[model samples]
Target: MRHQEGLALVAAAATGIQVGAAMVATRFVVHDIGPASLAFLRYAIAVLCLVPPLLMSARVRFATRDLLVVMALGIVQFGVLIALLNLSLQFILSTRAALLFATFPLMTMIIAACLGREHLTGAKVAGVALTVVGVGAALGERLVTESGTGEWLGAILVLAAALCGALCSVLYRPYLARYPTLPVGTWAMLASVVALAAPAGMEGLFTETSRLDPSGWLIVLLIGLSSGIGYVLWLWALKHTTPTRVTVFLSLSPITAALLGVALLGEPFTPGVLLGLGGVVAGLWLATRTPVASSDNDV
Candidate 1:
């Protein structure tokens, strides 16, 4: 493969790993901390990790108008989406959460169509149907075996997260076109940190400082590092590839999360899960192959 292709593949794989592990780790840390607090710490640590790079790069200036747009993106993407996703973990399994979150690509396609960036081809519609079927198959088995209100709630929150995430992806391109990716990402994260600080502060960042066990601390560190690095990789890939191509790899996230659940949490691997995984992968491939106008080339 060419160097850019190889890098895109690497970025996709890294994002898969980061998102999968982050899901599991968030569940672990949420055991000790509330979802809001955990979200705060995750971004706070990520902001700290990003600052060194931000300082080293030549500063990118933003107009007053664009500052609000970036901040809005940050609020929706990191603030609302992440907080809802973490809250969903309170009710759903990590695998189920990941599967629901995987719907973002289809959501992004729909958003693109609405924005006049792309037309929704029939293949893309079919892909979305297949993905939804797969997710239903996977979760249906679990719902039959062990049903609870919390699990359903989690699933709903994850769906909401997917919607917000799609919006963020659609909104990011204009800023990315005009500004450096790293700087744009840095500001977005910084905005998230500020937005989350108040609610997180009420929970007492210092008080929880002593509450976490050693393993919990390790999980937090991994979440922080993965998030910081993952955003950089995602932004880099966005610079080089179409959003649909980048979104296609997101289907891999649930598979990774399922495997992690089996390895880390001893969750049983069922045939239904396998079938669902296959469906998700196949659907994403079909969706990505369906031509949509490139975001970069759109009006």
Candidate 2:
């Protein structure tokens, strides 16, 4: 049991680091490619990566009903949610975006309660409030200093992405209950690729191929690899942990992004940023500590 617990901790930590690094890589890719195109390539490459394992997995078989549901999840999760999130970068700083997305735990809790999957408790509510406060504290400086239509628009886009992501999380419960994690993840990724390919192709696929410098290619590759591997780890972690526990780790993304900015982009680490990081950590702990059913068993 002790060994198993340690393994779970390692898995969760790995998932968090991979996801954080993926976000940084995604930011780099977006510096070169447009959000839609970046999103298109992400899902496309992810689908390609998934194909081998999917073909070999015995759990790959799906009924028509399951396929449709998976397709819908892909549309909302990978296609729409990711696109909106990428677009949000145009208006918001990476740290701010990460902080805002950290609200996923709160959103998940509320949605689960509404769906009768969890009870609404005062502790959960407090946790949600703490999370919001933490995120606000972390990004408060930027919010105060930054003023523009684009910034506001970016904030709205990210919030919208959060809503879509929350919906996807809730909707995935049923399919996860019926299917194994890898197979479902593979199909969902395929569906996202199919959905994005139509519009992306019409825009002239590979038009930007000539424009990519070595660094751009490296960033794209990182995005692809990180997203593919990180998502798989995420699915695996979901299978072994609770939703709140899985989501709480997401708060680390902003902190990771801040560190990355300091290391890679030469961005300064201000006191406000540090304070915000503390808030985010506190909020995540509070949010995850609330009593909730483990939704991960099904996934």
Candidate 3:
């Protein structure tokens, strides 16, 4: 049990990094594609990537009722959540988008509490608050300068995406508890592909695919593949841990994005970013400090 918990923690952290990387990659790709198209293509390819493993794990099955619920959550995650995030990136930098996105832990905390999935503690609240303040500090000018302009729209959309993701994360716990993570992730993604097909088709997203160069196609493939693996790990982590604990590790994502943005996009690294990094780490540490008698672990 201890080993499983440790592994789940590791998976959660890695999921954060992979997600951050995907955001950075999306910054490059969304310029050439609409969000609907981007999301549809990304998850369509991701669904394909999940297929072989799912075939091997074909023995597991869910009742029709439970399957529908998971499928609905999948639509929220893949269609609405990712589609909004992709659109948000069109109007913001990857670093800023990541900063806004790093608030998912706070969203998770609130949703978990409201749903009776986890207890609300002072430390947890303080930790999420500190993390948000840090993200704002790290954002520096971007947060302030962009609000009055159209940038506010992007921030709101990203926040919505975070909320959607949190709700799905909290709601999916029961189903994940009853099923294997890979199969659950696979089915969810497949449902998303079906749900998103219409908007994507209306946009003629497939037409855009043919126009891309070899490098563009490569980027799409890598991003899709990353999503496939990252989502599977995310569901697996949720199987063994509390949603709050899993999401608190997402504080690392903005840090990862900042580093990756600097290296890849030549984005600036500043003193504020350093300060924010410390606060995020400290907040995550505090937020994840386990209560002695609480039932945060899913299993």
Candidate 4:
């Protein structure tokens, strides 16, 4: 049991890091593609990637109601969340977007608490608070460096995106507990693809995709592949751990974006980021010190 929970935590952490990397990649290609178009294509590719595993897994029938619920979640999560984030990138730096999106854990904790699905503890509250502060510290330098009339809009969009993800994360618990991760994730993502289709068409996804340079195509492919793998890891982790435990790992996203910026975009590494890194690490340790069982009945 301990080993499984440990692996779940690792999976959650890896998913967070993957999402951060994808954010950078999305920022690179978003200008060339409309938000709806990019989201459609990204998840379309991700669905293709997930289809193989879903076929190989033992099939289980979903109740009609559950199917609808899961599909709605998929639309909100991959569809709405990615669309909002992509739109936000037009107005903010990837690091700034990542910083704001890092609020996902706090949002998840709050929603889960309100839903009576999870209890709040001092350690959990402090850990969530510290990680938020840490993320702000890590990306605070860039907040001033990148500003525009749309910056506030970008922040709002990112927050909305984070809220979508948080709600999905919390709501997914019962379904995840009831179903296999691969099928649930794959089906949910497929639903998002269908949901995005009309919007993608309106945005000229077909034309935009043809115009992409090889480098841009490469980035999109990477984002899709990572997203497919990340979704599975995320669902699997959530199936094995509490939502707070899973979402708190998202604190790594902004840090990953910040460090990647230094390496790839030639951005400077500052002392504040270093201090933020420490806080994130310490918070993770404190938040995850006591492992909660994965059962949905726990409250």
Candidate 5:
């Protein structure tokens, strides 16, 4: 197998970091609006971010059958994933939600192996576990202290979101490799709009839509823009590497959030941050190690 897959892991880590920042950003605004409504605005704005990329580039044609597949997966990724996440947030702190959702790699590993898409490797599993532990360390305080409403319910909800996200990640790989990132990402996000509409409308999102202030709209826009950018990066990574490798990078998100807090919110770096960072680095190192038959190392 031809190598050059390292770039994909980097891209995946970058995607994780970007989404991590978005996660932190969401905490501020999710409380101000309903989860369904917030999700609606996020993807709606995400679609807008895709406009320039889809427009300026040469159009890439997709087979009608494949396009439908992309749409179905998008509904799961953007609609189901975020819907579960948002619902979970209603019952727990965002930090707690994030820690639980970090279990995505475990789910991805199981799904990928069961589907015969990737082999089950000890290194990969350990990497996933390491990252999850790192996330717990990084957010340990908030995760343990939060006794919010339906905390277990929220944990269960986010875990379900992780499952949906894991499946979507693995399922989208073929389509992402077959199509251009901009169009594929954009179309997938577009499909989610329909999926999101019913829930958002039922949540009284439409009635409350007009109530958001300028600041709230800004938060929504930022989240949307990040979602669009993050989607493209994620697809790019998936196009180049094994699904397990991509999911392993998700452990980077909590670390990214902690760092962002220091840089953007004036928080102090602590011993926990250093410990978590070590785990993240160790996890990535193991996750990216070339297997004995790995094509990338075939020279």
Candidate 6:
């Protein structure tokens, strides 16, 4: 059991890091492709990768109502979330976008609390406050230096994307309990691809795709493959561990994005980022750490 828990933690951490790297890669190529187009291509390729595993697995059936609900969730989670995130990159640095997105777990906690699925302990409330302050610190510095509405627009988009993720995280528990992770994830992604088609077409995806240089295509391929792999690992981790334990590992994402953004994209790592990162990390620890009595099961 300990070994399985350790593996789950590792898987969760890997997914978080993969997301940060994918963000950097998305920032690299988004200039050449429309947001909806990029999201469509990314998930379309991911569905291809996911389909093979699903085919080999034992068959599973979905009720008509459940199928429709899952498809709608997929459209919002993968379609709307990725489209918005990709769009935000056009206005903000990947590091900033990631930092802003790191609030996902906090948002999840709040949503769960609102739904009466989880209690808001004093620690949790404090953690939420700290995370909000941390995110504000990170963005406040930028608001001063940059002269434009783009930064604010990007911040709102990223937060909206995070909120979407948080809501899906809360809602997915029931469906995940009812289905195998691979089938659910693959079906969700496939649904998102179909949902995104109209928007992608509107952006001239067919025409713009031909213009991508080999390097750009390679990055897109990497993003798609990583997303598929990360999605599986995330689901597996969730199966083995509590959601708080799985999502707590997301603290690594902003750190990964910040370091990679500096090294690869030459984005600055300002003091505000440092302070924000510290607060976010501390907040996650405080927010998600189970009581000593529950720690054994949580792990």
Q: Report clashes for each candidate as comma-separated counts.
A: 0, 1, 0, 0, 2, 0
- Among all windows of 10 consecutive residues in model 2, the one with the lowest summed lDDT is 290-299
Q: What are the models' TM-scores?
A: 0.87, 0.85, 0.92, 0.96, 0.92, 0.85
Give the candidate number with the greatest lDDT: 4
> Which regions of candidate 1 fall more than 4 Å away from where they truly are?
1-10, 132-140, 207-210, 290-296
Instruction: Assess candidate 4 and give its lDDT.
Output: 0.89
Which 10 successive residues of model 3 have the least lDDT summed? 290-299
CA lDDT, every prediction?
0.75, 0.70, 0.82, 0.89, 0.82, 0.78
| Candidate 6 lDDT, 262-297, residue by residue in tens | 687697878877786787667756765545234323
- The TM-score, computed over Cα atoms with residue i paired to residue i, of candidate 4 is 0.96
lDDT of 2 by residue, 139-182 (tens): 65765776555777887888899888777766776776577877
CA RMSD per model (angstroms): 2.7, 3.0, 2.1, 1.6, 2.8, 3.4
List the candidate 2 regions with Cα displacement exceeding 4 Å: 1-16, 147-149, 207-210, 290-299
Model 6 accuracy (lDDT, Cα): 0.78
Clashing pairs in 4: none
Residue-by-residue lDDT tens digits, candidate 5, 1-299: 33547677778888888878888888777778778788888999989988887999998889999999999999999998888888787788767776788899889889887877777778888888888888888876766666877988988999999999999988887787678778988899999988899888987887654666788789889889888888888888787777878888888888888888789889778788888889888887877785533432111
Residue pairs clashing in model 5 are: 1-295, 3-296
Residue 187 lDDT (model 5): 90
Greater lDDT among 1 and 4 belongs to 4
**lDDT tens digits, residues 1-299, model 3?**
66787788799989988887888787777877778888888998999998987888658868999999999999998889999999888777666778878889889989888877888889888887887777666666665565434577888999999999999889989998888898889889999989888888887775554556678778888999899999999999888878887887777777777778678869788887788888877787777666523466543
**Which whole-number lDDT from 0 to 100 does residue 168 have in model 2?**
75
| Poorest 10 consecutive residues by lDDT, candidate 6 | 290-299
Give the range where candidate 5 is weakest over 10 consecutive residues by summed lDDT.
290-299
Which residue ranges in model 4 land beyond 4 Å of their true spot?
A: 207-209, 293-299
